[model samples]
Target: MRPFSKSLAVQIFVGTIQRLPQSARPSGIYKTRVNMPVYLNINGFEGDQQADLRVHGGPDKAVQLYPVAHYAALIKRFPELLGKLAPGAIGENISCPDLNEQEVHIGDLWQLGEALLQITQPRSPCSKIDEKLDCKGVAAYIAQSSKTGWYFRVLEPGMVTAENRLVLVESGNEHYRLCSILSLMQQNESAAIGALQRCLMAPGIADNLRLKIEQKIVHLNRASTGTP
Candidate 1:
């Protein structure tokens, strides 16, 4: 067991839903940086709001985390987007330097400050983030690039701060890596069905994601059977 200690939660954040002048829809995508202490509950950060409950903020998808390094890489690729792509640009509840899809695995448990957290699944990026950055195709690019972040469920709700670290106490099922799962879904749904089913049965998978995989399985079944 290699030490899984890393600087997780480099920046804590929360946001309320607001209507942007450019878009007709309301979104909580614009997160505010939190320098002080905050509460992490079973649902999510106390002040954070999820505009679309259908897709986000459930018990299993309570905390969203993104890698700080990914933002820098994106900036290097698209220099024009330097300003728009900040710490909380993608509506993450935590901005971490090493808490990326490549490092973390589904069901990985950690001691995050006073709260116990578990990795659930890779984040499914939406078009709202693309619009937030005033850039088209960003969401698709994120999916294709496999830099989309991961989600965590709060097992032990408690107060946490930006200064806290995430010390991995145990590794989950190593068969499923966030990036690998996402890549499989994108490239071949048939190939991903088995993994998705396993994830659905896994203890740590988010409910929303389980529902999604179930729906995909149905669609694939119909496609294969030629059931129009």
Candidate 2:
């Protein structure tokens, strides 16, 4: 609308990463992830091999990143960024919760008026998040849930913020979104591959996304569809 509003005074940042006790990567059908530091960009993006996977909070494993009030008490530690970042950053977030508990669970899908994205997995605990928190055992709990991280694949890449309206814009078909296919991959390889293959068919989905989906698909078979 504003011919790309990167100049619209949009504010964004890297939030805290919750770490856990050291643990080995779990034995799983998909990728192997070890317990480590996982970072959050306040507006919901968590760092991952994929582009920023949007989420609701820190892994409910140990530290919860939502409920802004919890984070507000912690924000005091960052005085220089007091007003600049949102002296009330956490407060503003808790006042209006975005994705609900059930929606965050694996296999759930959501639609925000900003864009029609679908969450596929949880933000797995990474070593970087552990370093930021200076804590242990954080990553283990995350893997227990099968390293499921919250992911919001962009139906449309649009701007976001801590002060967003936080609304549910659409209710999705249980099968069409990525949530339905992700869990199935562990048990039903053919079906999972079929579903993921369809997702990669979307118009603007990136090459990275295509490759990740193809990799998961290839684990069952042997060939990749997209070239990284």
Candidate 3:
């Protein structure tokens, strides 16, 4: 088995929520970065929200949670020592407990121990990061390189405080990691279709993601396979 990475905590600030559009948002969550325990989960996405946890604090943005960075300037100086196989597939010296279920695939969701949360999409780097660092397009660099962060879909609504054990529950298709599958999907439509089909068969995949996959399948089949 591959060695697991370590998990880190970052405190969230409450002021950031003011920037979000109010909808499906629970009032009282903080916006500042706070130290919260992020663990590996079987959902194929890192930093899963627990079923018994209500997002106590996060940006009022659509997905309320803090996104950790995969890139660290500290390791860039020693890329040769890092043995970066694919630049950003996994960060150098990755230290987090985010598990991708048994297999880790796209459109996968997992329940925290018993019932906690549903990790869905990864936190792709955005322009907002550029301002944070005063560097234009830094976020784009991390995203293009595949160091995109992760997020969770709230389930089993409860409070998520610091020191949460963040149990890993297996749900959806635990076969292919989302990043790997996405890479394949972009190249070979046939393989992408197969992967999407596999994801379709997984238990508890979110309908939105599934629909997106299906749409891609339809478009790709027509473009690459010449669907009749």
* TM-score of every candidate: 0.87, 0.41, 0.55
Scored by lDDT, the top model is 1
The TM-score ranking, best first, is 1, 3, 2
Report lDDT (CA) for all predictions: 0.79, 0.36, 0.41
Clash pairs, model 1 backbone: none
Model 3 regions lying over 4 Å from their true place: 1-15, 18-31, 35-69, 73-115, 226-228
Clashes of each: 0, 22, 35
Sort the predicted structures by lDDT, highest score first.
1, 3, 2
Of models 2 and 3, which has the larger lDDT?
3
What tens-digit string does per-residue lDDT give for candidate 2 at 71-158? Answer: 3333354343344333123211112223322333322223332433444333344543333234444345334433233344444434
Error of 3 at 92 (Å): 20
Which of candidates 1 and 2 is the stronger one according to TM-score? 1
* True-structure Cα RMSD, model 2: 13.4
Worst 10 residues of 1 by lDDT: 1-10
lDDT of 3 at 217: 82
The TM-score obtained by model 1 is 0.87
RMSD to native for every prediction?
A: 2.5, 13.4, 9.5
User: Could you tell me the lDDT of residue 221 within candidate 3?
Assistant: 82
